[model samples]
Target: MIQLKAGQNIPLTGDVVRFGAKAEAALDVCALVVAENLTVFSSEDVVFYNQFATAGVVLAADEVTITLAEVRADAKAVLLVVSADPIAFPGGAGLGPVTATLSEGDTVTAEFAATPTAGETALICLEVYRRGAGWKLRAVGQGYVGGLAVLLAAHGVDVDDEPAQSDPPPRPAARSGQGVPAMTGPVSGEASTVAGAPLEVGHGVERLWMVFEDAARSAAALVSAREYAAERLDHELSLAVSDPATRNTPAAEEARRVAQQRNDELIATAEHRHQQDTEQLMRELADADQALPPALASWDSPAWDKPAVSSDGIRLGELYAIDRGPLRIPYCVPVPLNRPLWIDTESTRAVAPVVGALLARLLAAAPQRQALVDIIDLTGAFSGFTGLLAPVLNGPLITDHADISARLQAMVDAAELAELAHTSGAFPAPTEHRVLLAADFPHGYQTADAQRIGALIMRGDVIGLSTVIVGTNESDSADTTVATLSQSCRHLPTDGGTTLFDPWTGSAWQLDLDLLPQEPERQARFMRTR
Candidate 1:
């Protein structure tokens, strides 16, 4: 076995180069094949056997092998990367160093050093490049604060810009052929100079160690389980043992262990409490589901006898009733232009279809195209209606929180324009009457966002703008329409019908809301024109 230090270059003697890390650590090995001009052909050129396509690299359980024959003839070199799972950092924040050595049958193995700290997540281990007509290997032990995604992003790979989730990327399948066993031992974090001399302690070295320590503590706090904490402690102590500050100080080791243990215990306790709360919520949903009536046969069922559309705007669905009486008068609920409508459901599944149908009806019934429609769907619950409302939609479907805020600011500007138009008696209103459909409330919104939405709901009527906010939970703002789905169809109140509690009058009304007709022809026609 050959011991390779960082910056040490060696000539390659084989066509098959294998990059492998210990299986116990669950590290992801990636090979970045770059052209001599330093430009990547495509995202696939950086291969790591995940959702992204691998170009010239072949994946195996313990290592990723690069076949020089399959590589583009014009390619300059390959940068081998070993990345820790950003979510868990299985062995710690950093990936141990990787060594390249020639094995029997002309196969080369790149073995990683054991991780030094629990905090190092991303590392650029080594580079194999073309030197004139021969290939050479150079050990470059560079550490990064984030995971594989960050490393890939640095190299110009366009990854999803959303917040990282807890799930780790899929692991590679086991290799079919066996070549050689990796060298076993802890690898050094420090890299050697190109002159084959030990690197002197410098500001860069001190800063890198500080970054590792900070990442270690942060990773320890992120996980809420005993096993994760213990794993972090093991990796941390391994580095601590080699450090000058904690190597001889037995008391420091004991203190760190005690603190880590306490943190684990606290995390476990919090998780238990959260589990109990979730169980209680589940029980409530189950009871509500049971109390709901049988599902309706269709949207056009005669059982929904009450007229949803009359002289007054749109009506909610029919009411729930225990007994039928001839003298009982059917109530028609109106969603007026100036007033905001709030619909709350007990079901976990989204009810955006129902909201979309109502908006379509209102927009279709508008006078001389005086009204326009805008939908702010943070949860993507209303994506199905994108085709139907494409013509009248104010902007693209909003999925980002920042975009929602910007939309609201634009609405505020429109409101100011509407006020001027109303005062000056302009021939046409500065802002057309708009019906904003907001679904899945409070899920992605911050406290400030909720307040801004509430203000819009309060003053919408005078500005000829109306909002229909739909959510799973109840809210105190605006008049509310309480509903529950039975057999995947909307069911309104029966006895008096669904209850509509008016915040303005402080009075409750029992009315059967009308179900709008699902006209496919009308929808297609509207989609084609204004």
Candidate 2:
């Protein structure tokens, strides 16, 4: 129940065709092709230097597969592809050279390649008959479209990539001594393309007598060799067709399965490496201890640049114009605890609420309590109490006295207590670093605003309680201010100087900068202004 078709002649441009209700049948090897017969080459029009008349046919489409790229390379050759239909791929998926569902007529100049990514391979070719959706295939003929590509890969072509000379390199004439050859000057290191897709090449010659002579000689040479080759090819194909023992050989099946296993391993390795790289990038950003210098506002500029905080609020750096175009768009909701940010020190972009809770519980329970209490200015000392916290340390957990984590623990323990008794007058309160910072700085703030707030903290007279002044501003008229406290006030050397002046306590204050290494930048920045 099959109809004969006078299909359109396939040109050198290549072509396509749709099979109508083809009986799902296996093909016998010895049959000659007719107008009723349909066949597909494993690689169509494969020109192998006058070696054979044409390439071998697969006869069925769904038995094989091809890997493809989303965007085909505009390489030096003709890259031909065929597909059945338009297919959407996830994450901009890349498809290989295989054809999808072919339309009624089989010639297509527009290849329907649904590739996932750029510069990567996709499966483009396939065996025609398969086990799934009943979509017809579009036959692919690569050589017909773009033809051959000749590259001088063996020579020192790569050296051409270096800096070009003032005078162009000498080129061998395509035809020497009174000749009109097709080629011109020397090859620029760049690939000299022969116009179309990536495909096989043909050396051109124009003479009927010579062409016939060459063809005859080639055919004669092939005929001379056919007796030996045909015997081997026939024997191989016969073993595949006739002897069940040979046809069902375990070696071939094992080889295929082993190849499949190796391919799977390779793909898995690639994917794992990609994931690891991404995780490493995230870790670098999350664990930046002493990375780029914190952006400092010089006194001479007299204008505000928001203090550069990392993706989180830890050590502030310089505010560069990095977050441009898209990053400028606001993310989700505003964080409520903007002021006490200096204490949290967790990255702003990380999953924070859980860490915040863990810190709170740890601060309340760790046995080293006294050192934690002294760091905060509950008695009205330092100026940045209302500032937020960002994570400065996420080192390994160690219990010994000399361990870095333990050392950090001591400093943090002291910092936490100071946070509790100082600015808010909420003494003896549960010490969650995040909660304490929130109480001190109860709102969202931009980086410059945080710096301004830091400056205001210096104005604390009553300090930590009352008007809650942060910097040296004297004009704030708070009725129940947090900045007016007198007990915790003290002054030390103005950064690099030996002068001691207490703007808040108004007395001779003695302090050693070497003991508070954490505030060195803060000291230098503010001292320079004075």
Candidate 3:
């Protein structure tokens, strides 16, 4: 059987298919007959435990059998859904490790682990939809904290609007003292659960961010569940051995043993759930990383294995977590960056190569003529990159204090001219984006130079100008301008010691530096503009 990850789809070969979902907890398997617009036509379209069968969709025990040939002509797809059976788990339980399968007779053709986080109670496991003259199945591991009703409502089916018999009671939460703590990082069924701003679609980067948000929520939920379970176990054990009168009696010993056994079972279940969630997330991360364009891909990503290509965003680095196995979430900012970038040399490794990788990304975003690069390296740290990108340089590399000040003043003056031209319509807007790379900062910068640096950092984005400065992470040093710049710009430590906060949840994720390849030939191939 072929295993599938979330958002993956495959074509089906047979006409008669059985969609089965099995979990450690009892599940109410159901199917929705959705039209082309993704809405159910009537109450008869929703086939659940109460309504066993409808048209070609049938709920038989743990599986939903569908005769594709017998389905309604207007129906575009059949959605396979599963929710925790309220009758079996009255006090609420997670739908853990839901193994969904597609079978033709006794042969399983495809499978997916539609695992939800700790708080989720319902999930849309799979979808068998029309693909021209045939059918295709998709692994959709979207979860719902609000249970079956919410899942149905997202598909335009309101159980409350239907007849009384169709309205299933809302799933119950764990009763008081049942030891199940309130769930953390509540994941939504239809959209992102990232707390702050609604994620913007397109640009490819937002899609990756959505996937990162999913991984974050799943990881946090697992941690929260594990901690809560352990605490609950401790409390239960304490209660079990509290009686001094029967402390040494056989009954007390049995109670303690039972408590410990129950705790172990809970922990075991939690571990299994975490393992499944992690595996699924790793698959997703790998898939997303592999699909990333050259601009967003890591230095070692297969995307760079091929010829150079351009994309919508620039890859800053990636988020690293030891507990998350091999999963690496690529971090990206949009093409026209909103702020300057400060590469902290104190905390990162191989500062020159890191700068090279970033410059390469900026170059890849636009054509050679449209990408203007200006390098200032008095320390000769970027000498290798200077030679590799000599063909695309706007001017000679500035290596002296006088040249450094001249370049900064020139950029600041150009920015003012560009803004005036834009407002007066006297000249066409600047067609090219300028990138400034200043290495070993504060070495040649004076008090007046800092003001010029600050001006460029503030208004450069408006005039197609960007700055990448290298310096220490000293936000409170003697140099007030340096300290303010340190605090203001989007900063990344060269060694990946510090963390970058996610816009959605404000979670701190360590930045994994994207170092340039060690081979000179490889570096040339990547750095030299195509």
lDDT (CA) per prediction: 0.48, 0.24, 0.69
TM-score of each: 0.34, 0.17, 0.60
Off by over 4 Å in 3: 1-202, 300-302, 305-309, 347-349, 426-429, 495-508
The positional error of residue 76 in candidate 3, measured at the CA in angstroms, is 24
Tens digits of per-residue lDDT for model 1, 1-530:
44443333445777777766543456677778765333355777887767333545666764667666676665656777776666675434455533433232444343334343535566667677654345666555555556666666655567786425322322211122332111110012112112211211112222222222222222222222444556767766666576677677877678677767765675666444334433433443233223221111123323123222112233234322222111111222222344455555543134554565456545533334456666777666665556677767788877776677778767767676666666688735423557787666656655555655655655555466767766654433332322211111122322332343321111223344443334666445322224
Better of 1 and 3 by lDDT: 3
lDDT per residue, candidate 3, 1-530, as tens digits?
A: 87665544556888899988888887788999986445687889999988999998888876799999898876768989888744454444567788999998789988988667645678888889764467878776777766787678867786574321133322323323342222111121212223222223223565565456555544454454556668987887787678888778898778878877877786676556556656765776566567666777656668767765556567777776676445567766666554677887752235887898888888766553377788878777877767888777878988787888888888889888877777788757457778988777777777777788788877776566767888776567788877887666667765545444443233345667787776888888677565
Model 1 alpha-carbon drift over 4 Å, by segment: 1-312, 326-336, 346-349, 424-431, 474-530
Per-residue lDDT of candidate 2, residues 335-449 (tens digit): 1122222222122212122223222222222222210111222212233321222231223222222332233244445445566566677655432222212111212222333
Candidates 1 and 2: which is better by TM-score?
1
Model 2 ranges off by over 4 Å: 1-248, 268-289, 292-530
Ranking 2 against 3 by TM-score, winner: 3
Q: Which ten residues in a row have the lowest lDDT in candidate 2?
A: 325-334
- Top candidate on lDDT is 3
Structure candidate 3, residue pairs in collision: 347-495, 348-494, 348-495, 349-494, 349-495
Query: Highest TM-score: which candidate?
Result: 3
The alpha-carbon RMSD values of the candidates against the true structure, listed in the order shown, are 26.2, 31.0, 11.2
